[model samples]
Target: MLNRFKSVVSNVMGGLPAIPHQTEIPEDPNSLQVKFHYNRPDFLFLTSDEVELTADHISRPILVPRCVNKLPWKAGYAEVINAGKSKSNEDQATAMHFHIMAHMTETLLNKTDNQVEMTDMANTGGEFDNSLEYTYFAIFDGHAGTGAALMASNTLHKHIQERLLEVKDLLLCSNEDKMNDILKKRNMSANVNLPTKRITKDSLVKGALETAFCDMDEQIARERTTFRIKGGCTALVALFFGAKLYVANAGDCRAVIYRGEEIIPMSTDFTPVSERKRIAYLGYLQPELLHNEFTHLEFQKRVHRRDIGKKILCRDALMDGWFYKTVEEQDLKYPLIYGEGKRTRVLATIGVTRGFGDHDLKVHSSDIHIKPFLSPVPEVQVYDMTSCEHTEDDILVMGSDGLWDVMTNQDTGRIVREDLRKFSQNEDSRYTSAAQELVSKARGHLHPKGRGWRMENDRPSSGDDITAFIIPLSQLNSPSCSINTQNGHIPEKLENG
Candidate 1:
């Protein structure tokens, strides 16, 4: 079957060689060392041979965790490699608990000496205060390479932990009367004197998430000087802290809440077309960035050399509607943003406007860097899980663009919900089964005659690497969900799974 699958793909492309992805190893073997080897997320619990099976483009098996205990809430996760798009799956995902150690802040306040240092929880032989725990789920969709995605999947949570720890007091304070007292202690510990500003719990978490993305991106940039971290990737993260669910997005990856039959969008897709105004405005502000090879103006049609000075329908960075503008020599240059819908490209190079680590990506045959135009800051949206009632059927679905490329949010919700109906709510594998069904629908089956992969309806299936997570929101409030941790990265045995 696998051989036949490969033969079909070969014939479909007319025997053309697969194009090299951005994450491919450089021809020069002596470049700086790549920081890490490509691997599936540890939570997946795949054996070495099973990991190898994931890279088989022809088989394109939808990989899922072998054990229900692998994820919190027995969350369902499924991923598949693209059909000969890259040498390996460029997408990466992580599911873990980030513990904001309560002892650090508690020790500082109780100790008489201001110079007293906090000891590590492991060294102290103390248990973690599970109340301050936060659940983190993220998906990184690599474009040029998997390095950025791999790097993010491994360390992005640490950056978030650092930021969250800074405001741990505010996050834990439930009494409104003690809010100012908490702020006073926070100011005293830092040895700083500044007027207090109104701070909300959700805002603190959101700010932490936003800054964490920036820190993660900065780390990738700084480390790349000594390490070979190829390509860039879009990030979509869903963080569950206290009663709130925060979704931070910095690229085309998406997150949605499926409550009952309703599909609530939690993040936006920052594509070139969706972010046209922002991209074009930057081009207008810094024309030098274009290298005179592109223009910020948008035209109804490409302005030809012969049509210079002719009237054309156009719009500028400030206007939304097209106006009649006289074409000029500059207008003949390529538009800063090109194509439409999923085909949109910035400076005719990248499709995404926000992500991490594309520092060296330049325009084809030009010195113009695309990094300046790309942003690592994520737009965070919050959903209060405590505000409403939820059931086992309610879930948070997060996926890379590969899944969304071929499925709508409603379609995804319906597939997951319908598949989940086959099993009892207590059966955690039900979620995994739902995730598998979601991935399978997006991935589809090989087309008849091996021409190409296609869906049941005969539409082309998603050829990009697809990943999905179905997290039951009903388990959010369960006490057994916390990850006992001495340090952030090390996962202790869960009290409950």
Candidate 2:
């Protein structure tokens, strides 16, 4: 069956060979030798000066690690633990938290055919402001192809920072009357207005965030490049602002905060169609679409007929026939093509109701009839620096979906908590290495039965790409600062407070 589908795909591409699947290897072999440590009250840091000094470093494939022993699967299982006080008098008691998130790719290809762009800058003294300190982390999850994802991850941060600085004059106005006048003229709301009077170090943070995402979307369109993939990526960024943590998210890649054995999710999943209320708002009849067999059949038949140009509905023109041919050749029973014969009505093609970069698939709200099918606007979530409850002992875990696939939130929390406890109580314990160890452990846990073993289907489950960073709270003594210089590099500092 898979071969038949592959043949159809090859024929469609004019006999061009299908792209081969690629998998991630373990950490880069050329990666420098780095160590994580706490500097002062305002900062926690990881440095690789030695690793950077090491010449002739070789690149390594990022692959999953195989397990030496086997373990059973436990459905929805999670474990949490709390570490006691450390022997060291200077260190404060901190809490830990974690969570797991997973989503199936739209394509059936076993391998993770994606690309990632990651940049981490620390302890840099620059002209912007020597007094301020900061750190920046971003994860871009792309689909269809990795080009857009790579572009967005590499450039979004810098683009946003530049825009905020360009608008600094407008953001720094002190007079309320004048500010109000300018905002009203620009149609900016006074309620959520930027703090112009103070113009402190933290003032530009919010403005920079808003402009970054808004501008990046527009900039990509202007480039006139066909490399922009059809699907879009979800991004989650963490900016350590002064002593506080600021989180901004668009899409599902998540930022989770751990406060001493608890899991706090900092981002919301933007699934508009998944929500019943949103579905109803689009005028979709709930009962008619609620797992009803007849309704499903009717929708499939309608869509199939529309494909052949037999039926002309108000929304028929918007249907992209590319999906029709793909589905037919695969012999897949899509939602639009169900039932044996003579009875089918197309409801919808894709399952995800909201996403970016599918502007062509959108239906105008004024159309009234087909408005329900149009994609929802992207959602933006912001976590203020003041909102998070921070302590000297807290730890922050930022990761992609790969880590969450084989582990639970509770499992991660427990492992970190226990490791920290061991390190604190035993002077010889190397608990500081937990971050790198966790990644290796996760890779090993993937296939205790055997390498590439898929428990459900009895086939080799292609390993996922995993990237993560773990920071212990006590090491967070530096003032957190990030600058998205226009040059496409986001430099950050983890300074001692």
Candidate 3:
């Protein structure tokens, strides 16, 4: 994992890999390690050979799913390998539809002789409003290695479903009357009492999402000791449940909604530059995490040895504005965070501040662990899908940092709008075309004579891995996809524009 990061820093240095302190982990010959092979999303339907071909840095082909029907809502997807940054594409994505069984709720509520029993009500085999169906979309941007991203793509949704099942009963209780009726019918169990404070259904769903992310991260940490999981990854997930859309993000990947003439941001990037204070505060709280080689304070400029005992413009963990402080011997240590914008780094190591794995990640050659300063918690945002009237033109575009590195939210919306207008109303492939257009625009054209890739505006193109998903919000607005309170069976009539 550190080797890949070293290559990135090496490329930035315009020469050989210059980061010397970072080293690769030596494999133990006697220990058994279960490893997961790299491959594209199964929905893409690419053969094993084709998956390997997609990683070719020389050709750098943009890959999309074989059929639009592979994804629900006829979602569009596209991805491309980096310009030799790593041997394989570190980014991975997932699109899945999950059904919460009615029995799951009864299994939790049914009881007999102080023991939970699968009673007749639990095995009724009947559909009810208590059951639910939801769609999940996620992107994992891996760094160093693809192990963490691969595991996240393969298992994160299962964790989410597990958490959702735990709260199925509460999710069904929409109001006080419904909750009281269900509680009374279940027979006054002291073990299952409502909270002292009022809790909204939205809060239950959000908590499920938040805890799911934590569970996924914890699994990675626990299994890595016995498995071959390497490095870490940022997770960005969008859950379409009931009549609401919940976005939980813990990394640099972003999600934006295109509605009419405006672009709505659904997720925020968690980078060292954006979350400096939170990381700095942790450093200040536990100085031992820094190993005495780093400080929680940030200065406008690097403090030289001569500057010691002199006042310098600085900002501490709590201060936002810079203030003059005398530089002491400890202040001469490296700042907890360094650089700005895309160049920002924590301990002069990783760029992102939140995500999964990275339990063994340390600062270069030091013993300081980076995981303590990193977070697995995601920032969640919710949008009521029923509150807005969305048309076929409206879409939710989710992409890794590679896509956003070159294009702004407005630029992406404009391009998607332009591409969607090119196809007729009945074209189902338009969404895929729109996704392809976004990847193409971000990747740009490779130049000859070793000049490297250049964007349409003559700027350097993104050399990192790129992945994007274009989901039509029109499906969410369609009556066929909505929950049926009377029959509990939603008609499968989701169509693409």
Candidate 4:
């Protein structure tokens, strides 16, 4: 059994308001210590304040000044277990593989504003190859607060699982023998009314996935209605099944795969401008004329007032509010007073271009020609399946931009590699124990009082929610080519265009 021990030593200072006095300090130390009895667990410490005391540095513990104020602190861990072990003992050689250990942690940073940071993990057991098993890992980066990131991280594993199951069902249905066997076993009539014949399992699964995203978009729209905040999140997912790896992403969240000492990016960032071109090509551009009124009538009036006839500005009209105002004012009083017309400014509201929500901006041509703002439709990308070769070990790191902000890619990879080496020298070591040590090292390097830990805004570091999971490929049991054989050879190159 793996256990975690957390000790919080908070010291209270009570003395003259402005005077420095030496008092008997409480036996409780101000620093937190996490010691493991069975395994060498990793330590992650987040503090609010730091102070200098007696030539030594100490974290100034957070104080709750108001009775109604709530101080935020949250952390938890999960343990993954074998799925089949809990169900039956039918087959010992069935390759009953699953994540045996999983955990997550969340901490509230600000109470009034509800600011928080969270990290979690998802593991879908190794494939049943009876040969070799591999693990899949992913990390989510969320902005505009932690809710979106939390939701994405918690739901992503299930989404991929369902997708894989759909794929399996499709393959099963494709085999005519399997379908006939099912009919015979269930004693179902051949002419019985079955759902649409045109509906294949593959098409239904793809449609289901698409519909799930659409429904999520609707929920996001409804949530945005209550708040005026503008921002969205990004997600990066990495899958490892057998010797093949696949990655998919939308928005800016990234996934980096490590093959030996080098790092490879598996996804692309989707920006607003890229999505705009698609929307425009879809015949969604602002109408040239509302019924019969010229869309650029106001613009033309401005040109005439400036005595520059038929001259196209060529600038992005969507962003230049001045140009829109010049046009609208010119349209209001066109031709009559070219030089001496009183100038008036009409402000138009423009929406964002790309994001998960903001349906209001997705209005079609019939809607009034409110100045064009950007939209937030995310660009989704998938990586081609590729086989990674490693001599001794391989490390995979998945994190939000928060970790990137504090440590470079090389630095993160090196730290994980060094920690792995330490465990290698000790034969009686646990991977999870080493993982915790790696996290501790990262926290130490970025802690306030630690050698390089910077102090900013009374928090440990300006780091965002940092979450990572590492896998040692060499130590894992190699399953036979069961997945490839059962699933019918996965393609070597499956890149998204």
127: Cα error in model 4, Å:
13
Which 10 consecutive residues of model 4 have the lowest summed lDDT?
Answer: 1-10
RMSD, model 3, all Cα superposed?
A: 7.2
What is candidate 3's lDDT per residue for 358-409, written digit by digit as tens? 8888776567778888899999999889778888888999999999999999
Question: Stretches of candidate 4 above 4 Å error?
Answer: 1-136, 171-215, 218-232, 271-388, 425-462, 473-497
TM-score of each: 0.86, 0.48, 0.86, 0.43
* TM-score, ranked from best to worst: 3, 1, 2, 4
Model 3 TM-score is 0.86
**True lDDT of residue 382, candidate 3:** 93
**Candidate 4: TM-score?**
0.43
lDDT of 2 by residue, 146-183 (tens): 43355455456555445444554454455445655675
Backbone clashes in each candidate structure, one number apiece? 3, 44, 0, 26
lDDT of 3: 0.79
- lDDT tens per residue, model 1, 383-436: 989878999999999999999999998899889989999999798699988998
